[model samples]
Target: MSAAAGTGAKRPARRGIVLALALAALVVAVFVGANAHLVYVAVTSQPDCVPHAKEVGIDGAPLRAARSAC
Candidate 1:
């Protein structure tokens, strides 16, 4: 009877440890997924640049700045 009680207590403790580890793994997976999405957006998106018409030189000449594929 004492041995059976000890085994039952150990089973619950083992289950608790397994649950904690699974929760930790889920948190890590979510964190990694969010970071990956952010990286993808940063890589795929383009930056906005000032248009050529908006810029003018001091000598009244139109400044042809480097154009971007906006």
Candidate 2:
């Protein structure tokens, strides 16, 4: 008999590989969806600029920069 016919070992199963690919795709989809939602919210929401403390903090820095003098 030829050497090719002498071996009886079975080929490896692909179920695990398919399952792992599905899980990776699911994670990527969720990540992209979340980022898209965040971008949408940022673009849609526009609150008027509010007042900020004019004095510097103890650290000698503004609490936060005022977008406008409003």
Candidate 3:
């Protein structure tokens, strides 16, 4: 009887482990999906990932050299 009860007690622990693994898999899927979306947007929306020199600079001054990166 005690042996049967011990096995029954382990069932909930096994369920908890399965639930944790499923939750972890869900989180990983979300992260991968988000990263894929970001990559898609980056690749599809740009002629160049690097911006134009004028866009990078302000009023003919190099932006980063003139100002501290905030």
- Leading candidate by TM-score: 1
lDDT of 1 at 35: 100
Model 2 misplaced regions, further than 4 Å: 1-12, 52-70
Worst 10 residues of 2 by lDDT: 4-13
What would the TM-score be for candidate 2 when compared with the true structure? Answer: 0.54
Model 2 C-alpha lDDT per residue in residues 1-23, reported as the tens digit of each score = 56655443222335667888999
Instruction: Tell me the spans in candidate 1 whose CA falls farther than 4 Å from its real position.
Output: 48-70
| TM-score for candidate 3 | 0.64
TM-scores, all candidates, are: 0.68, 0.54, 0.64
lDDT ranking of the models: 1, 3, 2
Task: Candidate 3: count the clashes.
Answer: 0
lDDT of 1 by residue, 1-70 (tens): 9999999999999999999999999999999999999999999987776445535574475665555454
Per residue, candidate 3 scores C-alpha lDDT tens digits across 1-58 of 9999999999999999999999999999999999999999998874434333444566
Ranking by TM-score: 1, 3, 2
Which pairs of residues have clashing backbones in candidate 1? Answer: none
